[model samples]
Target: MQIQDLPYSDPGVPDARSGPHLLWWLWRNQLGGQLRSLAWGLLHFVSVSALPFCVGLAIQAVVEESGTDLALTGALMLLCGIGIAVGDTFLHRAAVTNWITAAARVQQLLARKAAHLGSALTRRVAAGEVVAVSTGDVEKIGWFVEALSRFTAAAVTVVVACVGLLVYQPALGVVVAVGLPVVALAALPLLPRATRRADLQREKAGRATELASDTVAGLRVLRGIGGEDLFLDRYRRASQEVRHAAVRSARMWSLISAIQVLLPGLLLIAVVWHGIHLARHGRITVGELVTVYSAVMILSYPLRHFEEIAMAYSFSRPSAKRAARVLSLERPTDAGGSREAGVPRGDLYDPATGLLAAEGLLTAVVCGDPDAAGRLAERLGGHPAEPGVSVLLGGVPLDDLPLDSARTAVLVQDKDPVLLSGTLRELLDVPASGAVSAEDALAAAQCEDVLEALVQGSLEAADPMDARITERGRSLSGGQRQRLALARSLVTDPGVLVLDEPTSAVDSHTEARIADGLRRLRTGRTTVVFTSSPLLLDRADRVALVHEGEVLAVGVHRELVATDPRYRAVVTRETEEDPAPAGADRNLTGQGALLGASDKLAEIEESA
Candidate 1:
C-alpha cells in the first residue's frame, strides 16, 4: 500500500500469534510497498556500482589511444551518474512511504484493539506499555519493515558485483569473492550479546515510563500526602537504571559497528594487496585492478546493511512481541452461545449476586466492601467477574447478546467517572436514544454550579456548553466533576442505568437533590445504583443489602433499617438507634440528622 492510501479501510484482524509472526504478517500485508521500494533500491545500488566499471573502461580506452572508445566510455559514465541520481531520489521516496504506511497500519490495528477491549485493556496491560507500543514500538516495527527491501537490494547488488568481478579478472575476483562473505559473517557472534542488552534496555525503559505515568496521574495525591519527593526520587532511580542499560546496549552495538568497519577495511587492504601482486606478475591489467578496487569499495556500502538489518531485528523483535501481546487480547465471551442482536428491553438480573433490578424501577444496592460493590456493578452491566456468570436482561442472557447490543441496553457509570478533555457540548455528545436532552439531564443532575464554573472565565456571550473542560476535569472541583459525569450518563437514557456511588463526591444536600432528581427522571427505567448514602437509598423503589458477596435483604430503605442489623450497620456505620417516635419526620433524627449536619458543614465550607 502507498502512503496516500494509508489508514487501511479496514485494519483487518492481526496475526498476533507471536512477535516474528506479527512482523511477517505486516510485511506480507504491505508487499506492494515493499516491492516498489525494493525495485527502486535495486536500480540505485546497481547504477552506483556501474559507475566504477565505467571509469575503469574509460581509463582502458584512453590507454589504448582509441578516441571513439573514449567518447563512448565518457558518455556511459555520464549516463550512469544520471541513473544514480534519479534512482537514489526515488529510492528514498519509496522507502519513506513504506515506513510511514507500515507504521500507520500498525497504529490502526492498535487503535482498533483498544476500542474493542475498552476498559478491560488497562486491567490486562500497563497504561505505559500501551503508550510505548503505540508510539515507540510502532516506529521500531516500521523501521525494520522499511529496511527489509533496502537490505534485500543491497545483498543482491553485492552478489551481482562479485560475479561481474570474477568474470572481469579471476585472480582479484577470487580474493574479493572470498573476503566479502567473511566481512558479512564476522559480526554474527556479537549480535546475540547486543540483542540481549537491547532487551534489557527496553525492559528498564518500559518500567521507567510506567512509573512516570503513574507518578503524573497521582501527582495531586502525592502532594496532598507530602510524598512528591518520594516518587520523584523513585523515578530518578528508575531513569538512572534506564540510562545505564542504554549505555550498555550502546556499547555492545558500538563494538559491532567497530567490527563492521574494521573487518571491511581489512578486506579492502587485502584485495588491494592481492591485486598489486597480480599486477606485478602481469596477470591483471591496470583497468582490471582499478575495477576490482572500485567494486570492493562499492561492496563495503552493502556490507554495512548486514549490521543494520541485524540491529533493526534486535530492537524490533521485543517491540513486536509487546505489540502482539496487546493485540492478542480478546473480549471475554461465553462458550456454546449464539449472540442475539438488538437492544435488550427487560429487567436486569445478576444470577451470581441474586440481585434483581425490576423493570422500570430504581434499585439501590448497599455493599459493605467497596471492591465487591464495584464488581457487582460491573456484573449488573453485563461485565461479569468471570465468563458464563450470566447477567440477563429482558429474559435474555447479556453475555449471549452482541457486545454492542448489551452496551446499548445498559450504561454503567463508575464511581470515578472520567470526563474526557473537550468542550462541555463534546463531553456530553454520547450516543443516545434521544429520550433525554443535554439541558434536561444537566438540570436533573443538579449541574448548574458546574456549568457556571465552566463558563466563569469565558466571554459573556459564550454558551456554558461551549466552555472547555481540562483533562479528566482536573480543573473542576470533585463535586462538579461528579455532577458533570452524572449529567453525561443521564443524557444516554439507556433502558438500564447502573451507577456506582454517583453522588459520593457531592455534599449531602446536593446528593439529596440528585437522588430526588434521578428518581423523577428515570421513573420508568431499570436503574441499579450501588451506594450506601441514606439520601439515595431512601429514594430507591427497592433497596438490596449486599454483604459477604450476596444480597441478604431486599426491601424499602426504612424497613431494612428496622429489621436487618447487618444492612443498618453497613449503611449507618452505627448500632441501630431506637425506633423513632410515632409520626416523627424521618429527616429530623438518626441518619437524617447526620446527613443534615453534613449539609450544614458543606454550606459553612462554601461560605469560608
Candidate 2:
C-alpha cells in the first residue's frame, strides 16, 4: 500500500485471539507491502554484494597492467553504485510505507473499537493502557512488521553471499559460513532476560501514567482537601519506580547489543586471519583473498538484522496481546429483536425509577444525591445500570434498538460534557437532525460571552467561529466549557435530549436566560434536565423528585417545595450553617467526574 493510502478503507476485523496471532494477522493482511519492500531490499543487497567481486577484478587488472580490464571493472563498479542508490531509496520508501500503513490500521481499529464500546470500554480498560496502546504499542507493532521483510532480505543476502563464496573457494567459504551463524545466533540466549526487563519498564510507566491522569483529574478536589503534598509524594515515588525500571531495561538491551558487536568482530578476525594465511601459502590468489575478506566485512551489516528482528518480535508480542485484549471486548447488548426504526419521537419511560418523561414536554428530575442523578442520566442514554433493566422510548426499550439508533433518539448530555479542540464551526458540525442551527443553539445555551472570550484569546481568528479552542476546552473556564458543550448538544438536536445539570456552572442571571431560551427553542420537543437548581426546576413543565433511587413525588416545583421537605433540602441545598431562601442563587451541583470517570476510580484500579 502507498503512504497516502496509509489507513485502509476498512481496517477489517482483527483476529482478536492471542497477541502473536494478531501480529500474524497483520502480516498476512499487509503481504503486498511486504513483497514490495522485499523486492527492493533484494535488489539493493544483491547489487551491493557484487562490489567485493568487482574490487577483486580491478586489483588483478592493475597488478597485471591490463588497462582494458581495469576500465571494464570500473564501469561495472559504477553500475553497482547506481543500483545501490536506486534500490536503497525505493527499499526505504516501501519499508516505511509498510510501517506507517500498519500503524494507521492499528490506530483505526482501536478508534473503531472505542466508538463501539463507548463508555463501557473505558470502564473495562485502563485509560493509561488505552493511551499506551494507541501511541507506544502501535509503533512497536509497526516496527516488527517492517523489520520482518528487511530481515528476510538480509537473510537471503547472507545465504547468497555464502553460496557464491563456496562456489568460488570452498575452503574459505566453509570457515566463514560456520562462523556467521554463530555470530547471528549469539544474542538469542540473552533476549528473554531483556524482554522481561522491558516488560517491567512498561508496567512501571503505565502505573505512573495512570497515577498522573488520576491526580490531574482530581487536582481540584486534592487541593480542596489539602492533600496535594500526599499526592505529590505518591507521584514522585511512582516516577522513581519508572526511572529505575527503565534503567534496568536499558542495561539488559546494552548487554545484548554488546554481544552483537563482540561476536561479529570475532568472526571478522577469524575470516581475515584464515584468508591471509591462504594467500601467503598460494592456496588462494592475493586478489581472491581481498574479495573473500571484503565479502565477510559486507556480511556484518546484514547480520545485525538478525539480532534486531529478534528484539522487535520480543517487544511487539506483548503489545499485540494488549491490543487484541482490547479489541476482543464486546459490549453487552440485548439485541431485543429489532425495534421500530420509524419511531423517531417518543417519551422516555423508566420503570425502575417510575420516571415518566412524557413526550413534547420539558421534564425535570431532581435527585437528592448528585451521583444518583448522574447514574440516572447515563441509564436514560442506554448505559447499563443493572443488567436486564432498561429505559423505554415509545414502548420500546432503548436497548432494543440498535446502539446507534438508540444513541440518536435519546442524546444524554452527561453532567461533564467534553468540548473538543477545534473551531466553533467544527464543534457544532455534528451528526444532527438538522432541525436546529448553531446560532439558535448558541443563543439558547447563552454562549455569547464564550464566543467573545474565544475571539479575544485567538490572534489568528478572523471571526468568533474561526477561533480555536484548546484541548478539552482547558482555555475556557468551567462555566464556558459547560455552556459550549450544551450548545453543541443543541446543534445535534436529538429527539429526546436528556441533560444532566446542563446549566450548573453559570450564574443565576445566565441560568434564567438559558431556561427561557431552552423553553422557547425546544417548544415542541421532549427535554429532560436533571438538576437541583431552582431556576431550572421552576421553568420545567413538570418535576419528578427522586429519593433514594426512586421517584418519591411528581409535581410542579412550587408544590414540591411546599409539601416535600426532602425535595426542598436537595433543591435548595439548605444547611444548618448556611440556610438560604427559596429564590436565592446557586448553580446546579454538577458532580461530574471526568465524564463519570472520576466517580469510579476504584473500579478503574480494580479493572486495571
Candidate 3:
C-alpha cells in the first residue's frame, strides 16, 4: 500500500498474539511489498519438502526387487537432488525478500506514528526508547514475520513425513510422531521467564541510551561548570547496570538454547533406538531404517526454527508496546476542517484563566517564573494549555475552532525557538506562503551582518535568500539563531503575536531597533510580549507585573519601575550602589559597556 493510503490515525489498541493474526495483519497491509514475498516463500517451502520424500521413495524402489530398476532409481534420485538444490536457492532468495519488506513496513509505521505525535512523542517516551524501537525492535519484528511461513511449511512437512513413515512401518512412525512434539514443546514453559528478562534488558538499555544522549547534548555546559567527571561517573554506573541486566537476559536465553539442543538430540536418539528394535523384530529392513534416521536428522533443523520464532516474539512484544504508546499521543487539533480568509478580529480571551488581551493593543505579561509565562503564551495561541486555561479568539473558544484556524490567527514565539538548517532566506520561509520578504524581515530584525554573511557564503547564488542551512543552525551564533527565529515569527504576520523574550539575545542597540520595528510592523495587530528586558518592556503600550501568578500592577514600564521595587529589579538588575533607571529613561546606548561593569567587578574579586 502507498504511504498516503496508510491510516495515520491510531489503530485503537494492538493485540498481543503470537500466531497467524499478526502474520495476516502484516500480509494485508502489504506495506513494502510483503504479499509478493510471502507468495514466493510458500513456493520455496513446498519445493524444499519434496527433497526428503523423494530420497525415501528412491530407497524404497531400490529395496523392492530387481537390478533392472536400479539405474532408473539412481537417475530419479539425481533429479530429486537437483530439484532440492534449485528449491534451496529460491527459498533463500524469497526468505530474504520477506525479511526486508517486513522490516520496511514496520519502519514506515514508526515514522508515520512519530509524525502524528509530533513533539509529544519525545516528551512521552524517552529518546533512547525511540532509538531502540527503530533499530532493534524493527529487526526482531521482521524476523518473526519472515519465520512464520517457513515455520508453517516445516510443520506440515514433519506431519506428512510421519504419516509416510507410518504407512511404511507403523512401529518406527509411532516413535517419530510422539518424539518430535516433545522436542518442540520443551521450550514453552521457560518462555515467560525468558520474556521477563529480555524486557528488563530492553528497559535498562533505553535508560542508558537516554542518559548518553542527554549527557552529550549538555557536554559543553557540564565542562563549563566542572561537572563533566560527575556526569561521567553517573554514566559509568548506568552502564554497569545495563551490563548486569543483559547478563541476566543472556543467562535465561542460554538455558533456552540448551533445551532446544538437548531435547532434539534426545528425540533423535529415541528414534534411532526404536528403529533398530523394529529391525531386530523383522518389521523393517536396513534400508528403511537408514531412511527413517535421515528424516529424523532433518527434522532437527526445522525444530530449531520453532525455538527461534519464540525468542523473536519475546523480544518484539515490548517494542511493539512502546511503539503503540508513542502512537497514542494526541495530535495537534486542526480537526474542524475550515480555513479563514484575512485574519481573526478583536481581543483573544483565555476563558480558563479569565485573561484577556484586548483588540489592537500591546499587552505585556510579567511573571517572575519563566515557566508560568510560557504556559500563558501557549494558552493564548491555542497550544496545549493547562487544564484550567482555555484560550478564545474573537469571543470564540480557541479549542472550539479548528486547529489550523486558531494557529493561523495567533502565533507564539518562545524564547529558545528551534532554527532549522537552511540558507538564511530558506529558514525564514515558514508556513510556506512567502508572506514576509527576506529584505524586510532582516531589516526588522537588525541582522544586516547575518544577511551579508549568507550572501558572501554563496547561499544567495541560486536564490539570494535560499542558502543551505545545517541542522539546528549550529553554524550561526546563539544570538543570530535567536534573531532569525524572531524574524521568522514576525514574517508569519498573524493577527496575534505573542513573543517570550524576543530580544533577550541581541545587543541593546539591536534590541531597541527590533522593539521599534516590532511596534511599526504590528501596527494594527494585537501583540503581547512576555519579557523583563527594559528595552522591550519600555516599548510596550502597557506592562503587567505578575506576582504570585496574579497581575499585581499594570501600567507603562516607567510607572511600574518607579513604584514597584520588584518590577525595577526584574527589568534593570538594580542593586544598592545604583538603582536601575525607570523604563525607557534607562541608558541603553552603551550596550557592551553595561555588561563590562559586571565583568570588571568579578575580576577584581578574583584578584582579592
Q: What is the per-residue lDDT of model 3 for residues 1-608, given as tens digits with 9 covering 90 to 100?
A: 33343442443233335334444566455434444433444444444444555566567667786555666657766765665567567667656666666666667767866754444466567877788778887777777777666676666666776787777767787888888888888889999999999999888888888898888766767888999999899889999999999899999889989998988788788878888888898888777787777777777766777888788788867766665555445545433434444345788776544556777878877777897887677767766532454566787666566656667788888777877766666776677336557667777887777766666667336554766666676666677778888788888878888998888877766776787778877777789999877667766788887765667777887677667777766666665456654344333423224434434544775699
- In model 1, the runs with Cα more than 4 Å from the true position are 334-337, 459-461, 575-589, 594-608
The CA lDDT of each predicted structure is 0.87, 0.84, 0.70
> In terms of lDDT, which candidate is strongest?
1
- Per-candidate RMSD vs. true structure? 3.5, 8.3, 6.6
Clashing pairs in 3: 349-392, 422-469, 423-467, 423-469
Measured with C-alpha atoms, the lDDT of residue 124 in candidate 3 is 67
For candidate 1, list the clashing residue pairs, or say none. 346-394
List candidate 3 stretches off by more than 4 Å.
Answer: 2-28, 31-39, 65-118, 331-345, 359-361, 451-469, 547-554, 562-608
At residue 415, candidate 2 shows an lDDT of 83
Clashes of 1: 1
Estimate TM-scores for all models.
0.94, 0.83, 0.81
Clashing pairs in 2: none
Candidate 2 lDDT over 125-185, as tens digits, reads 8988898999999999999999999999999999999989898778788988888888888
List where candidate 2 sits over 4 angstroms from the true fold. 56-79, 210-240, 276-282, 334-343, 351-354, 385-390, 400-403, 451-468, 545-608
The model with the greatest TM-score is: 1
lDDT for position 263 in model 2: 81
